[model samples]
Target: MLKGIPKIISPELMKVLLEMGHGDEIVLADGNFPAASCASRLIRCDGHGIIELLDAILKFFPLDTYSENPVSLMQVVEGDPATPTIWKDYRSAIKKYDQDFTSFEMVERFAFYERSKKAFAIVATGESALYANILLKKGVVVE
Candidate 1:
């Protein structure tokens, strides 16, 4: 095991993060997401919550500075009453790494799935929250 790496990150996930280049995107998929069908590369993080995974990933993953919205969240259907309070938790976690990070771009449900199909990789987590799926764009690491 690596000394500084978070125990939550599996070896395969760490390798995927290392292989990703600037502009590539990765998805943190909720339990409800169709991860298997949508992912180009899939990493199973079963029994893990998105909030904790988000926090752990941000420790080493850089957000795309070139994109207007480096972070994107799946939007709830128009008539759906689910408020997705977990989004605030996600925002808080992101702010810890990037103080300037504000809001996430809301992508339509179908669009989100389409985007997921093209993502560099998708992490299927055990989070039960509705609309918890998030896509993070990669950025170049600065020296």
Candidate 2:
């Protein structure tokens, strides 16, 4: 055990966070996401929800201050009739760490998968909510 590290963060997840540099992005894929096919590097976080992982990751991960939007989400398809209430929860959790955080870049479903494929790594979570996928860009940690 390490002091200050969240118990929810696994060794593989921690190592991926350490390996990432500024500008690299990580995807926190929802349960329905095709993470195995999309990820260049995949970190299995089975049985954990994205919200808990998001809060825990935000403790050590810095959002790109240089980018206007350091976060991205999968956009709901047209006429889907599914209202994603989880987005509100995402905003709340992100704001807890980044006060200046405004909104997420909404990527069309297929575009999101394409973008995720190019990410430095993807953490596949067991979040059951629809459209719960989120992507976070890494930033420099200033002293």
What local distance difference test score does each model get? 0.95, 0.95
- lDDT, residue 88, candidate 2: 96
lDDT of 2: 0.95
Tens digit of lDDT per residue, candidate 1, span 1-143?
87989999999999999999999999999999999998879999999999999999999999998999999999999999999999999989999999988779999999999999999999999999999999999998996
Please report the TM-score between candidate 2 and the true structure. 0.98
Candidate number achieving the greatest TM-score relative to the actual structure: 1
lDDT of 2 at 116: 96
- What TM-score against the true fold does each predicted structure earn? 0.99, 0.98
Candidate 2's C-alpha runs over 4 A off are none
The C-alpha RMSD in Å for every predicted model, in order, reads 0.6, 0.6
Per-candidate count of clashing residue pairs (backbone under 3 Å): 0, 0
